[model samples]
Target: MKRLSLLLAGALLLQLQASEPSVFGAGNLDSDSPYGLTESEKKIVENRQNLKNTKRKSQENSAQLQSLRERIDGLQTIIEGLAEKTQENKLKVTELTSGEDIGAQRDAKIAALEEAVRADEANIASLKSLLESMATQVDAINANYVSKDEFNALVGEINAFKRDLGKTLKSVSAPAAGASLESKSSKELAAEAKASYNKLYFKDAIPMYEELIRRNYKPAYAHFMIGEMWHYRKEWSKALSYFKESAARSSKTSFMPTLMLHSAECMMHTGDSANAKKFLRSLIAKYPASGEAAEAERLLNTL
Candidate 1:
């Protein structure tokens, strides 16, 4: 019975030693037993663990790489949009520059057109003035051929020139309100003198004419008309004095020959016979075909 109990104890110890090799490494087991576990089982377990670790690491790296790629794509999209916007701005600037050039050209053309128009207006005005002057000369020449028609035409041209000159004078003159009272009065007297002469009332014309002469307002016609009035009045000496004054005042007036004839007559009537003959001879020499010349010849024959 003792031997059996010892055997059972020994058997239990052997079982404990075999299980210890699995709990600890082969070094803790009996040195005589070289293998700790089956080689194929160890290799299969290590390969499985290595495969699991490799799969976990691959998953983590793939997630990180996906995030970086998404960021790079987003940056690329932003850069592309910036490039497109810059191109659009460049086009707009180009269009604005082109528009400015067009505007400058248009302004230059407008200024040139305005200058051309003004030059044409001045040229047209000069041409019209030349035409009117030529027509006046032609009408004067035609007067000898077609008396009444040509005379009327000439008068019409003279009236037109007077009207144009009056308008020009008004434009050139100082403002009427600023004119002196004396100037205004002289103009009125001259107008009245002209009206009286136009009515053939030479007596009524005299006082106004004298007033204009006193004012020194274009006194040539005033002196000539006064001399004519005195001659008609048969005041020989007075007529001669006024006629001499008229002749001295104006050389080109229609009154010159008439005044000379009257002076000669006055000299003859006043008994200055030698002086009258000399004056008559001068009149005939100066005005060969004039009415004064005829009168002088008649008077000389009588002498």
Candidate 2:
């Protein structure tokens, strides 16, 4: 009976041992096996999953960084373009301001030229009147039954005077407005006229000088020449008219003394002795240091 009891206990112990797994067995919860895993294995699997997630996040962050970098680059390019455009606009503003200043200067110059033109027109009208009076006088002389040689000489002088007068008239009428004067440069034209006058080609010089006087109204030298030309032709009334005009026109110039002396001479030729003496006295009183005053004193002594 004791033996059977011991056997039964042993059998029960064996059976429990067979049913329960050892800690190192393949089926044990703490063992690593194909069907069942250990805690370390599970931890390794979780680490691997975490590594995959980290890799995916890193790739996504890299893409976002690259996108941000591209945007920054694009913004920098736009900024550079804007800076260039701003610089160009500033340059344009400066250019426009300079252009406006030039325009104002041109307008002022044009105004001065226009005033000169008006003076020239007045002188031209006076010259034309003198020419008409001379023509009438020549016609009267021709009607007095003169010799052929005298008539021919008188006609030749008259025709030559007419030609010169026509040239002067044409020159005064050439330029219409300020633009014409500016384009042709009034200063240059005046210089050219003076050069021609110095050559003593009075017929050629007359037109250019008249043009200069038309462009610059203060050319007293031009007026003096016209008076001298009429005086040389012995057209007494015409000569006196031009000399008086020259004297008045020279008031705005440096030739006032010369103009006054010539005007007195014209008065003397026109047989106005009283007026001539009066002008001579005035010349002496006003211009004591002038050559004209000395000449006046001599003339008074002779009278």
**Highest lDDT model number:** 1
Off by over 4 Å in 2: 1-183, 219-221, 232-236, 250-252
- TM-score versus the correct structure, for each prediction: 0.38, 0.36
Candidate 1 lDDT trough over 10 residues, lowest sum: 165-174
Q: How big is the positional error of residue 147 in model 2, measured in Å on the Cα after superposition?
A: 47
lDDT of 1 at 40: 69
Candidate 1 Cα outliers beyond 4 Å, as residue runs:
1-188, 198-200
The residue pairs in collision within model 2 are: none
> lDDT per residue, candidate 1, 1-303, as tens digits?
999999999999999987665545543223444346567655755676787675555444434333433332233233333434444444554555557556766666555555554554454455446535544554444443323442343345334433443233222222333233345577787786665453333544677787778878878778877776666556778878877777778878765777777787888888888988888898889889885787689789998
Cα displacement (angstroms), candidate 2, residue 140, comes to: 44
The RMSD of every model to the true structure, in order and in angstroms, is 58.2, 48.4
